[model samples]
Target: MSATICAFILTFSTLCGSRVVSGVLSAPTNVSLTSYNMNLVLRWGPPEGATQDLVYTTEYKTSVTNYNVGCVDIITLECDFTSLSVSMHPPIIEYGTYTGRVRAQLGSASSAWVESEQIILDRDTIIGSPRVSLLSNGAAIYVSIVDPVFVISTLRNTYAFATYSITYWNGSQKEKARHINNTQQNHVILKDLEPWTEYCVQVQINVDRNPNPGQLSETVCESTTSVEEAPWVPLMVTIFFVALAVTLVAVTVVYRKSISHFLCPKDALPQHFKENLLKPPNSTIYLDSHPPVEKWHEVQIIADTRTVEEEGPSGGSKDCLQRTA
Candidate 1:
């Protein structure tokens, strides 16, 4: 009984010692890969009941390549592998399928490596929304597009066959939106539009290999310029004519008598006098006709010398008096 008890104690001690010697930090959990706009990130959850300060190291691998060390001694739970570079290893390729692994470390102790789900760089990545701007021309709209920026490369560089899909509509009528697809130009002009009309535009990027298109951009609105004449032109002309007619009516009402006097003078004879003058006389005076044919008769001249001498100058009066005598 004594030997058996000692053996049992030894066995218990050995088991406990082995457990304490082999203990290590807990590994990260729920390791996963997420991508956006051609940017790749590896993320994981912290170990349960973890109280000690812990650091993490990540590794990534492709099907045809060996595992390569990624972020080392990182305290954060996430790693950005989009532009991460490893020693003696090439960068992540667009067509490559990748897997990631992360483990927790505390000094010399380390947990088991946890692997993440596989992800296709080109297929699984989401494309972000593009930016749109608009300008107005005469009866036309100029659409300017800016492609979505990416962590690895530009939208056009990554997707070589990419195209811009444009949609525009009159601001007043959204149901009549028009679409222009597969346009390669970033600056596009929409013509044959109504003059001085407000238009709203939206832009999206489309890739041939991608089944889903990019997110739609924010709607931008602008107004098209007038083609021939401004809308206010006709309104101003109508107003001018109305004002002119009003002025003319006011003048005619205020100065009617003066205008009538100017057109017909007041110096003309009376209506009765005009009628009498126009009428022929009934008979002429017979005595006046005979007196015009009478002969002239000589009359004797008598000089008044006394009155002339009193009224005239002295010498001339005397000469006149002597001649008269």
Candidate 2:
């Protein structure tokens, strides 16, 4: 009977040790926070030996005194928390520090708490809508902070401090134009810009000097002025004037030559001589005379005959005979 009891005890001890070994192997490990923005995310490796399904439970603690202010159950290796209201309620706290841990469970067995590194949960003050306007010689951008309603009695000034910067893209590259403290006036002049070129500008603001700054505001795009001139019109006017002057000179020369040809002739002579030279002369001749007497006849006879011809017929016959000879 003693030998049988020893065998049964040995068998029971072996079974219990095997079960404990399996449970230890099944616990998750290497649990840590992967990334965080406003919320927290936890990631861990899968459990080891046990085949049965396992679940993970996460808990957050704002203070070391209270370790279980919030809890969540997750079946997968990853877990996400959209909202963390742990510090807001009953146990009032300051602006920054918070801690959290995660655990794995299977059936009746549970693993140890895998605590995370301490993280800060500070309140972020957002810069309000920025004012943009065009100035006389440049552009101006104004940034303001949204006033928080809850006032802290310890601090004298309630206004949150903010820093701002203005940047402009000059087609090929970007340049930092100005830096403003506490959201003051930011003005930048667009000098020496190429005509008809495009420019892009951006304004950035950071509150509480957070290293990872907020989103950049929308870009403002504008084009420069044109540079072409009205030279063609002037050129056309000059050409027209030159052509008009040349035409007037040609007309004047032609008129002068025509007037000189008409008023003054190359050959100079008297008007009467010119007219007689131009007229045609007559060819016929006219004469009134008596017939010439013969040489032998005396002068008295010739004269008597001439007188008789004038008075009678005998004288006319004699004058006819003398004219025949």
Question: What are the TM-scores, per candidate, against the unseen true structure?
Answer: 0.58, 0.42
Itemize residue pairs with steric clashes in candidate 1.
none
Q: How many clashes would you count in candidate 1?
A: 0
Once superposed on the true structure, which residue ranges of model 1 sit more than 4 Å away at CA?
1-22, 86-88, 172-176, 228-325
Candidate 1: worst-modelled 10 consecutive residues by lDDT: 13-22
lDDT of 2 by residue, 74-189 (tens): 68776654344535533323344556677777666777777777655334323333434321212322222222222221111322464556555554555534333344344445
| TM-score, predicted candidate 2 vs. hidden true structure | 0.42
- Model 1 Cα lDDT, one tens digit per residue, 14-48: 65432223477667888998788887789999876
